[model samples]
Target: MRLLVSFLLAGLITDGEAQNWHGPHPWRANAVVDGRARDYNNEYFLHAFSYRHLIDRPSPIEEGIRGTAGSLTSDRLYMDFRYQQSFAFDDPDQAFTLDIQRAEDFDGSYDRQLVGFRQTLAQRWQLSLQGDVFSDKSLTDIYFGARRLHSEGSWLQLSLVLPNAYFNDKTDSQSELIDEPRTLFAQWHQQHTPWASTTLSVNHTPDATLDDRTQGDRVSSRQTRVALRYREQKGNWQLQTDLNGEHTRRQHQLDERPAPQAFRRDMASLTLAVRYWPHRWQPQVGARYFWLDEDGWFGREPNGNGEVSRQEPMLFGGMSLSLSDTQRLAPTVYLSRPRVEQTVNSPRWRDRDDHGFVGKLSVPWHITVSKQNGAVLSIVPSMRLHRFAFGGGNVQLHWPL
Candidate 1:
């Protein structure tokens, strides 16, 4: 924990001019606790803390803390802290940012730390470099990413990540278990017309895997994804379409032998919406179509010779209304056909031929605490109801700085 704290503190110290001395520093804290009596028990608790200060005339320090505790059938606790300092260059468009984050569990158990730097290269280009280290674990990841924007509201970006995993020989059975995972990704966005915009992105993870025998001999897992999205706004109507394709390969080593398993998924969706605003009454109608294709791994094969494939389609709609300038309400309904039972661990498991509908409603109210200083606050309470799915309620608070 000391090493993690040191890494974060080192990034916070930089040369800067000290302006007006402020007593302590400005800070704000917020917390939310919500519970609902559904057929099944559910509850959530969240807390956040924020602080900001001027380190110098042209440098500022910012920090935040986030924690969550709750039970959705299982109880979990999480806490994270972050600090960053921003310094300005001679040019207004150019600046440098150093950031650090540390996170741990309630019992001071598992911990992780990240330190990074961000720089504005030019008018439309930016770069970031980060390293993540873990406590009680000998694994580290170094990531480099960059973003660039064109003049015509178009932009492109790319990222490269390298992961290095190490194991301690004293307590571990394997003398040295080292696994390296490398990843590359790229994306672009453009506006085709005044009312239309499109985004295309592709990701490739060629070497992401685990090579520890004690970890069940998972080896050589690769994944690729390609996605496209288009949105158009015309008059009081809006149309959107999204398409995505994903392919994954996993190999398991049994007795030092490798066996290949693969899975591919394809999805497409289209939505059309129309809004009519008349005085205090605002009504919106929406229709949607969704299609999914799951191919390859489905379930444990008898002889490991055949592949499983399935398809599904879905429809959805929603509407909303503005109660006043400071208050609004909205509700949405969705129906979808499930295909294949998907789990976090195995891609082969998926749901098949299931249809259900879910509804969500939200109402938000705004209040101005001070008119002279333009201080405002908003509160929103929302609920979700599903016939064949899980539902919950949430409350949100917002304040402008």
Candidate 2:
């Protein structure tokens, strides 16, 4: 992820806009004139960065053009397979389970399969094994866990996650997989009452350096994350909130670079959502705040160290209006103001600064078909205009199984 940031920074310093000698980095002008000019790819990088950092995307975009959900109405077909079952023994105290799920996206973005098995050793105790198989075998993962039910409505889980668990997979070096560290995961969930519940989870990955043979680089990283979630239902309203924080330190050694580069990043986020479920209108509201700070050497050059900071707060509001006994229209709007700043040499030189208030509006029409097992099919088509000029339009389809 930081690699993209480094490339973007390089583009900013080499683009045509930086040719003038008005800025402090007058030396960059010579570099730009000496054949290190940025080409048309600069716009692509800027849009990609903006889409990830600033835009409130409504759905996943495939190949920078089409939305995943919107593609359902097109000629292409996509499908997912899922199967799960539990087997009981004569002892009545022992049982076995099998699970399999595969997602096949037409765009080849989420092509993966999960196979898992669980066995009950004793009452209220179970053990499980799960594996994730990705299109790239080097990215596979495996988990071995045990779950204990402490009470009627509470449980605890502990697991060991083996990152890049695949070995001798013809695709990558076996030594790189063997050197990856095993991550630790723990979670606790409790139900206080019929209407309220809470959950806490923690994950930690110790420092380790592994050869990314596929990319011809070396990465050393350590990360820890803690999160909590709360959900409750009171009267005619339902509420859910989440809080999480993470710290990460990473260093990268490119094959072409002689020196190693490193960075540290800290992030925190809060979210709250409320819905008046029992009301006719079914109004909903939610808000989220996220902040991040990163400082480190992002480029191959030693002098390419920098700091990046971002803060984003967003609000969401929506309601459902019944059009008929079998039809409804739900429209939701999102408003956000995101601020970002990037500087090199501490606070001495500013590289990029941007802040803006943007919004997105979505209106979806829901249709119920009783013959199709009362399935709810939603067709969402949206268009926008600014200053009497057409901006753009999009369409999406949703059908639940």
Candidate 3:
């Protein structure tokens, strides 16, 4: 369709800056700053950055205005919002939909928005186009998706995501830059019976490279992931299970370096949850297992070679009790022992083994807004403890628009 082609072309004008290093572990710049070394740690900063980059970091007030919490060198919290509306065109089946969303991470590092449009075709197929726009108004990525409806509660969907990039000027300071990577996503869902259903999904990102200006840091990576989910409900009881696995490979190089360093990572996790509902009270229990392995160079040669692995199994339980017709209180507790092993050949850093018991508690208040549309708002306050000592705590609010 001509409209679809125009949407795809719109993706090309997205702002694209050179991607940065994405090694498994944090990477320190070759140069030091103010008696300390500069480092790049995505997990902490929400993006890759070193000491020099801190100057450009947003202040707490700025973060708050954006509805994000947490900061570098501090704990993280997130606030997410979503709203959607649809309008019918000349034909009843031809509709234009607008979806707006904001999502951030616990640490306030990742923030994204979604702008979408959807159209119905043949009464069974739907075509959707969505753009991932950042707070700065720069387009990061776009998704084209098609869904085929087989019947109620059953469908098949496919999507392709293209990362946008552009060249400043071949001779200018900003040369070729690709801000993000391209990806392919697929999903299938089926409802065998009124009480049972299953879903499977796959996500793959082929090899992609980020080349900075004339000369700077460059990185390349490839990844694949698979996930399965199943749910069943009967007689006021609900059960759900989820399985996921992912593998990633990365190569990094400094400007004009002899060769790039290689890094590999593998992650797998499984979770099972069950809920029993009774009049005004509902109780739930869940178990989860998570594992990760990483081996690669984190920074410049001779200093970043290392291997790290972690495994954790956890159990959690919770219950919800209705306090009023539209209000309920839910409390949950979690317990886990995580073990991590790191082996590195470096002087400033030493190989070590760390394991500890971690516990967390959460109390959330839920209020129903629109019973017909199943809209609700939740306010959650949580606390954490490690080795019986107070670790940290956070409060989060979830509201649907």
Provide the TM-score for each candidate, comma-separated: 0.56, 0.64, 0.70
lDDT tens digits, residues 189-216, model 2? 7767656656777778777666655554
RMSD of each: 14.0, 14.1, 11.3
Clashes of each: 7, 0, 3
What 10-residue stretch in candidate 3 is worst by lDDT?
48-57
Off by over 4 Å in 2: 1-112, 133-140, 150-152, 166-179, 295-307, 324-327, 342-352, 366-378, 382-401
Pairs that clash in candidate 1: 17-56, 339-351, 340-350, 340-351, 341-349, 341-350, 341-351
Quote the lDDT for 109 in model 1. Answer: 23
Instruction: Output the better candidate (2/3) by lDDT.
Output: 3
lDDT per residue as tens, model 1, 101-208: 433211122333456666776678878776665553445656687879785556787877664434343324552323445667677777555556667777676744
TM-score of 3: 0.70
Model 3 agreement with the true structure over 150-177: per-residue lDDT tens digits: 9645788888876542222222445344
Off by more than 4 A, model 1: 1-115, 122-124, 165-179, 192-195, 255-282, 287-312, 337-390, 395-401
Q: Is candidate 2 or candidate 3 better by TM-score?
A: 3
| Best-matching candidate per lDDT | 3
